[model samples]
Target: MILKKEHIQELKNKLLEKKEQLLKESNLSHSIIKELLTEPSYDEVDYAEVSSDSYNLNILREKQLVVLKEIEWALKKIENNTYGVCEMCDSPVGLKRLKVKPHARFCIECREAFEKEQKNSR
Candidate 1:
C-alpha cells in the first residue's frame, strides 16, 4: 500500500516523539549514574551490590539503547521510503500493526519466527 503523506507525517511525529523520549530517558539514566558516582557509595558498587532492581535497570538501559537504534533505523527507512516493510521478509507490514509498534521491522508472524530462531540459536 502506498503510504499517504498524512500517514508519513503521523509516523514521523511518532518517531520524533520516540526519539525525544528515549533521549530523555537516557539522559536520566546518565544523571543517575553520575549522581551515584559522585556520592561515593559506602558499599561496593559492583554489579553484585547493584541490587536486583538495578540489575533490571541495566537490562532496561540495554533495551533502551537497542530501541534507540531501531528508532533511528526506522527514521532512515522513512527517508528511503521503505518504512513498514519487513527486513526479514519482503512484505509490507500492515499499517495497523505499525501503528501499534512503530519500530517493528517484521510483522507478528515473522517477528515471532525470528525470535524463536534467536532463542534456539542462543
Candidate 2:
C-alpha cells in the first residue's frame, strides 16, 4: 500500500528526533572517553571500575554510531520516496513495525527470515 503523506512526514520527524538523540549521546560518550584517558589517580579496584565504565561507554558509542548510520539511510530513503518499504521484498513495511523501528530496512517477515539464515549459518 502506498504510504500517506502524513504518515511519511511522521516517520521523518521520528527519524530526525532519533538522529538528534544519538548525536547527543555520541558527544557525551566522546567526552567520557577523553576523561577515561586521564591518569589513574585511584586504587586498583577504582581503576578497574573506570576501565569497566570505559568499556561500556565504548560499546554504547559503537551502537549509537550504527543506529546513526541507519537513521541517515532512512532519511535518504525518505528523500527518495522509498521509506517504509522492505528492501528485500519490495513490500510495504507495516506501520506498527516502522513505529517500533523507524530505520528498519526490511519488513518483519524478511527480517525474521534473514535473522534465521544468519543463525543457521553460524
Candidate 3:
C-alpha cells in the first residue's frame, strides 16, 4: 500500500522527536560519566560499586549510540521516501509496526524470520 503524505509527515515528526530525546539522553550520559570520573572511591567496596556503575553506564551509552545511529538512518530513509519499506523483503512495513518502531529496517515478518535465524545460529 502507498503511504499517504500526512502519515509520512506524522512518522517523520515522531522520528524527529525521538532523535531529539536521544540526543539529550546521550549528552546527560556523557556528563554523568565525566562526573563519575572526577569523584574518588574511598574503599574497596566503594571502588567496586563505582566500577560496576561505570560499566553499566558505559553499556547504556553504547546502546544509546546505536539507537541514535538507527534514528539517523530512519531520518535518511524518510528523506529518500523509503521510510516504511522493509530492507529485506522490499515490501511496505505495517503502519502499526512503524508506529512502534519507526527506526525498523524490516517488516514484522522479515524481522521475526531474521531473529529466528540469528537465534538458531547462536
Candidate 4:
C-alpha cells in the first residue's frame, strides 16, 4: 500500500527526532570515553573498572553509529519518495512497524528470515 503523504511526513518527523537524539548521545559518549582515557587510575582495580567502562561506552557508541547510518538512509529514501518499502521484498513495511522503527529496512517476514539466516551462518 502506498503511504499517505501525511503518514510519510509523520514518519519523517520521527526519524529526524531519533537522529538528533542519537547524535547528541554520541557526543556525550565520546566526551565520557575521552575523559575515561585521560584520567589516571590510582590502582589495578581502578584501572580495570575504567577499562570496562570505556569498552562499554565504545560499544554503545558503535551501536548508535549504526542506527545513525540507518536513519540517514531512511531520510534519503523519504526524499526519493520510496519510504516505508521493505528493502528485501519491495513490500510496505506496515505502518505499525514503521511507527516503532522508522528506519526499518525490511518487512517482518523478510526481517525474520534474514535474522534466522544470520544466526545459522554464525
Candidate number with the higher lDDT (2 or 3): 2
lDDT of 4 by residue, 1-122 (tens): 38998999999999989977986878855455434333222111112234577787877776676677678788878888888899878999999999999989889999888777766765
True lDDT of residue 114, candidate 4: 76
Clashing pairs in 3: none
Provide the lowest-lDDT 10-residue window in model 2. 39-48
Candidate 2 C-alpha lDDT tens digits along 89-119:
9999988888899888889999888777765
What is the model-wide C-alpha lDDT for candidate 4? 0.76
Best by TM-score: 4
| Candidate 2 colliding pairs, count | 0
Estimate the TM-score of every prediction: 0.74, 0.75, 0.75, 0.78
Clashes of 3: 0
Q: How well does candidate 3 score on lDDT at residue 26?
A: 74
User: What order do candidates take by lDDT, descending?
Assistant: 4, 2, 3, 1
Q: List per-candidate RMSD values in Å.
A: 9.3, 10.4, 10.3, 10.2
Q: Give the higher-lDDT candidate: 3 or 4.
A: 4
Query: Which residue pairs in candidate 1 collide?
Result: none
Query: Candidate 1 has what TM-score?
Result: 0.74
